[model samples]
Target: MTSNVNIDAHQHYWDPARGDYGWLTPDMPPLYRAFGPGDLAPLRTAAGVQRTVVVQAAPTVEETRYLLDLARGDDSIAGVVGWVPLDSLDAASILDELAREPKFKAVRPMLQDLPDDTWIAHAPREDAIERLIDLDLAFDALIFARHVPSLIEFVERYPNLRVVVDHGAKPPIRDGIDAGWQPWADGIAQLAKLPQKLHCKLSGLATEARKNWTEETLKPYVAHLLEHFGAARLMWGSDWPVLNMNGDYAAWHGAARNLTSHLENAEQDAIFGANARAFYRL
Candidate 1:
């Protein structure tokens, strides 16, 4: 029988005082405060979600450890997608250390913020990356649509590594389909065709579109992901606090459920939970 385990495959909890979150400035009052497991428990329970994969919001080793510490104390946290300076000499060693923590399921570099769009495609420190694959850890590509092409190249070099494109590579929903859909759609289609084990998240779209955006505004993009990756490879994520930038946890969760309602029950089950469990071994 198909398992009824519902998972929010992506989300984050950050304490800005750690000072690693350079992006969380006083200007963004909504996200400037600390967010933790306690803040999320009620919301997830209210939504009927039993577990979540808390991802990294900062590009620092300290932050990764903080997330792990939180995981150690919270059963609701299924896994963590932390960060490692991929180019550092100690990358592999750090991976080994983090891997010792069972909940350190993956690492995600903040690629979208970098000026070099192709950095991920040709990142150095193969030993570290290979070590990650050997340790059976996953890689989360935190990138934008422009990085998709290079991401394809990067994935080609590491076919054995499990990877997932966060936020459908942050599609240009705010720019509207006519202005930004073709390249993103085409690039995603190509990435989906690669023989590598690749996946996409049904997360962050709420924040990508305009604040007033509705589910219909997300229909074409969601449909594109479903068409390319299929429900089995597409996992749902709340993107939480950041999701609060444009909407709330309940709003995005409800929207995702409605968006995937047409699929068969099992397919819906996979997108909502099973795919993440299988991908992260959670």
Candidate 2:
């Protein structure tokens, strides 16, 4: 029988009252409200996405617990990439406390929003990074182009920690895919060298492209990822409410399918589900 195990390796939900989502302010009307299971269920069904790994939209242990509570009630939500104060000395203790919930799968520190791109690879966070390996938890790098260099170093140092670069480091689609981004492209290739430890998500592109995006506009970046990371390390994700700001869930999934139509059935399946199941341990 079929079940809700077809994994969308990345997605997110947030209630403004529960966490401090500074980026999700009143200015972004589309993402300024609450997004929950009920809001996403129909879209999931339509796209044949049965399960999802809910990522953190803010940087607080409080929000992580809040998301774990939601997963406790929703089986479709197979796991969570929750948040914790990475720089805090108490990070390991906090992770130990959160591990009480089996659905807690990974930790993301909102690296993209941080002022210093190398914050994750800095000396102060080394203890916490090793603790993740000891606890059998993952490190989800929510980073941007500038942070990819640090990401490479972080993965190399802790070769055992399962590190995933969220949204392919959020490439600048709004600026048009051009030659200026050769370094980002090179960084992706560098991360790819750590095949056994690194993973990437096919998500969050829609919002980055905004009104100027098209299927053709996104193909090159998708191809770039596929060329470096290949199908086995890539996983599909809706990016949900954030996706809603630019386009609907089904539309993004459709766009993803359209972009990768050249791949065989097995490769497509890896991108859509199987790889996620293995990576997230769903």
Name every residue pair that clashes in candidate 1: none
For model 2, how does the per-residue alpha-carbon lDDT over 67-134 read when each residue is reduced to its tens digit? 99999999899889998887888988888899888888888888877888787777436778778888
Clash pairs for candidate 2: none
Instruction: Note each model's CA RMSD in angstroms.
Output: 1.3, 1.9
Error of 2 at 29 (Å): 1.2
| Model 2 ranges with Cα > 4 A deviation | 1-5
**How does candidate 2 fare on TM-score?**
0.94
Worst 10 residues of 1 by lDDT: 1-10
lDDT of 2 at 104: 86
The global Cα lDDT (0 to 1) of model 1 is 0.91
Instruction: Report clashes for each candidate as comma-separated counts.
Output: 0, 0
